[model samples]
Target: MTLSVSLQHAFPGVSLDVRFDAPQGVTALFGRSGSGKTTVVNAVAGLLRPDQGRITLGDRVLFDAAQRQNLAPHRRRIGYVFQDARLFPHLSVRQNLLYGRWFAPKAARRAEFDRVIEMLGIAALLDRRPGLLSGGEKSRVALGRALLSEPDLLLMDEPLAALDEARKAEILPYLERLRDTFALPILYVSHSPAEVARLATTVVMLEAGQVTIAGPAHEVLADPTGARGFGQREAGALITARVSDRQEDGLTRLDCGAGPLWLPGITAPAGAALRLQILARDVMLARTRPEGISALNILEAEIQDIVAADGDGSAVLVRLQLAPGAGDKTAPEILLARITRRSVSALSLAPGLRVFAVIKSVAVAPGAVGPQAI
Candidate 1:
């Protein structure tokens, strides 16, 4: 269920044009408030008619200006979950969830209602009205409703925007589970980098109505083009890994494509796969292997690429292929590390230079899940 979209539209003063391919996993529409993220998604969902473009999911054509075809919102077979969790106030949670089945074709409604309810942990709220549920609870019910509809594509427009940090935290794991449990493609909209880091499989970056870059989550997130769209401080690398071992001293070890990563205070199972994000500022580089350091995970890597920052400081994004089994560099796993201008100049770093990357345990954030790149 791959989705491809290329669209151009006109607003009062800004023109919107973005083209990107979305994979089967959750594709994040990430940008600031007025960056046309929502506009592109709305066009895909049939809420906004793009002046020109084509949108297709596998074999279904939702929009094609060249063919003069535009499907209405209802007929699009896409379930939309807005920021407000727009559940019916008068209807019980059960009825609100069942409402989703009304639009689903008889043959297409194969998604089990009970399973979705259990997955979302909304079973207890089934008999209660939306008014009685908390913000997080209401959002879960909305998600269950969307799943019950068995949509081909799920469009979530800043679904966590309306909630506070506590409530947002409460719902994130459930969202992660949804991404893993279903085969449905999702176009998730968000301004929060944390949300993108935690949930995105593919990322389509947009600026004031223009597509900046689009690619795999880690690649795009680490690319300077994507990083510049956000502030330099927000620039970072997303790495995929799995929990290989856990220590009793509150440390977790991850087997990443680049190498093993050590993080502090994670409670995941030993075999649980995860995604790890390294903030640009948290990384330090070394020209040669240094002896005696507190850093637990140090990988010998060849610098594949580097990009200077806008002003005084430069952000050198080093692509690393981790030294493989028994300290072997021949079959190393690949990773990215962002170093500053001073370090780049001090070490005279160039592509192909060998360097040791030192990362701190607290620098990595949890809740990242993507396919391994090794």
Candidate 2:
């Protein structure tokens, strides 16, 4: 079921007016801090009253200002996860999860207790209190609690923001599992590009309380000027590749839409598909396939588009389409590379011009790699 939201609200210094439809998968509310990501989610969760708006889940109306209808938070059947784990300090982990289940209407209770524990890997910590758990453990329990609520819609407001790098890495896989295993719509608020690349099926880019760009994750991130909302450093594309083999040299081979790519290390076994995020800043373009380059990964590509990089003329972002494989009928695979204006001028880059995308084997971040849905 699609979630449709059109809201108008006002703060002391800023106003919020935006609308979007979230399809069945994870729809990310992504933007910089104070970009109104949280406000939009709050309105949807019935936590914030909008000045005027209409919110609906399929045919069910949660809020309609003109009709004077608004469902209370508990009545909305939505589960929320905040930045902090917020597990109960006085209760054991299992008890805290059951507490969430308690709020779920008996008719709406679909999440099984033991299954949630197993899925989140929290069975071992069932007896521990919040104070005794590590950051990652606490996060898993918090997510389990939300799942146990058996919500039709899940609202996660930067759930990983409070964790350190190690902790964030630990919980990301579980988060991915939640997205893949559950049959619920998720409204996730985040500004991190890596997280969005790995998890978002659809992206709604908010700028100063308005929708700037909204589309599929790959289309939005692969846009030549996508850096408008995601600063240059964070702009990137996500690619799904299946592991073909692990060579004796230690590098792993991945068969992606762009053809075979060799990365430093990939632990997933053969035939396992993985999502990899490639930042525009880490990609380099070559006019021709340079021979004997240090970069082990190179793909033949054709220039698809070009636009100013970072809204400045000093540099440009070139969108490259991988040369399609024989009989391939899927959408063209895209990659973005940031380069100086001089490079574009010297190479005479233009639409339809052939080139090579050169990337180092180690440029891929292991933390950003996650299992792709089959």
Residues 201-249 of candidate 2: C-alpha lDDT, one tens digit per residue: 8899998999988888888888764555778787777777889999999
C-alpha TM-score for every candidate: 0.92, 0.97
Best by TM-score: 2
Which pairs of residues have clashing backbones in candidate 1? 275-368, 322-333
lDDT of each structure? 0.80, 0.87
For each candidate in turn, give its C-alpha RMSD to the true structure in angstroms: 2.6, 1.3
lDDT per residue as tens, model 1, 325-368: 46433434455666677777888988888888888776665543
Write down the RMSD of candidate 1 (Cα, Å). 2.6
Which one is best on lDDT? 2
Which residue pairs in model 2 clash with each other?
none
Candidate no. 1 TM-score = 0.92
